[model samples]
Target: MKIKSVNLETVCGITSKMPENDKLEVAFAGRSNVGKSTLINGLMNRKSLARTSSQPGKTQTVNFYNINDLLYFVDLPGYGYAKVSQQTVEKWGKMINRYLDGSKVLRLIFLLVDIRHKPNQNDLQMYEWCTHYGFNPIIIATKADKIKRSQKAKQIKQIKETLQVVEGTPVIPYSSMTKEGREEIWEYIDMVYEG
Candidate 1:
């Protein structure tokens, strides 16, 4: 899973706008400001390949990044941003749902969450949606570097319990700052590609 070339293919506001390529797609889905873009940039070993913004709700579209022309890393719009209007939220919902449902090349989804807090209602709902729609979601607890080593296990446990993730699905602790869990994440992605 060595990434040789990473290119931004398109920024899709709706499913119809998604790239028509048939390459395997692994999407990153999570709430706003959960460090989705940061994770992607870290995973690719590119500092600014995916834009990182201090402000939440900056990613309002499905951003497609082509990796070595072998796979597509889809950055989905973050949900549950308070500043966004209801109409905009609904539009986003439809766009995400359509992309998830219609994409045949979608291999797996990385559901990112902030490691510091409890899983909120939106997080629970998104997890449920992934399960309901038959997408294999690997729960990623991002920003792991913010927490102490002693608290890591407890935080992971709380996230598992709160999210009610079952035995098969994994909840991996990850950090963009330290590149922690980066290899493991890629291993999982590799497995998905193999499958």
Candidate 2:
């Protein structure tokens, strides 16, 4: 899908209400420091529109980016930051739940994880939560270039086994720096919108 126009249409904080959107919505979920913003920036073909930061837990709101006036790329707040307090984390969790339970236009979720390591407890919980809410999330393993060529398969296998993902879920190895796997992700989005 060619992005002709991009607009940051909506931003929902922890206490704010999610907008009642009519277009198809796809969300990106992952832990802090997982390159969620970087992936979004790469996907949108823009630099820093999603606000990549040097610090973890930078994104604290549900940001909705209107794409070509057809779909919304919903950037959910990143979770699992150790330096953050438990109460703040819980609030973010509630914000995510509110979005999942209330978004009528939500069609898919792209769950991002670091490709160099195993899935953590928060990652597992997030995966289960997405499935429980009827979304078979597409796993996007970020930082693919950080690992060696031979290690990729083993790391991917570890992620799958650790998460216990559902059968046939796509686990895409993505590199924001190299823009690898970006086309496949866009193709999947096109498929969802076309069908």
Which candidate has the top score in TM-score?
A: 2
lDDT of 1 by residue, 42-81 (tens): 8888988887766677457888999888888999888888
Clashing pairs in 2: none
All candidates' lDDT scores?
0.85, 0.91
Model 2, residue 64: C-alpha shift (Å) = 0.3
Off by over 4 Å in 1: none
Looking at model 1, the pairs that clash are none
Best by lDDT: 2
Candidate 2 on 101-141: residue-level lDDT in tens? 99999999999999998999999989998998999999999
Worst 10 residues of 1 by lDDT: 13-22
lDDT of 2 at 89: 84
Candidate 2: regions farther than 4 A off: none
Report the number of clashing residue pairs per model: 0, 0
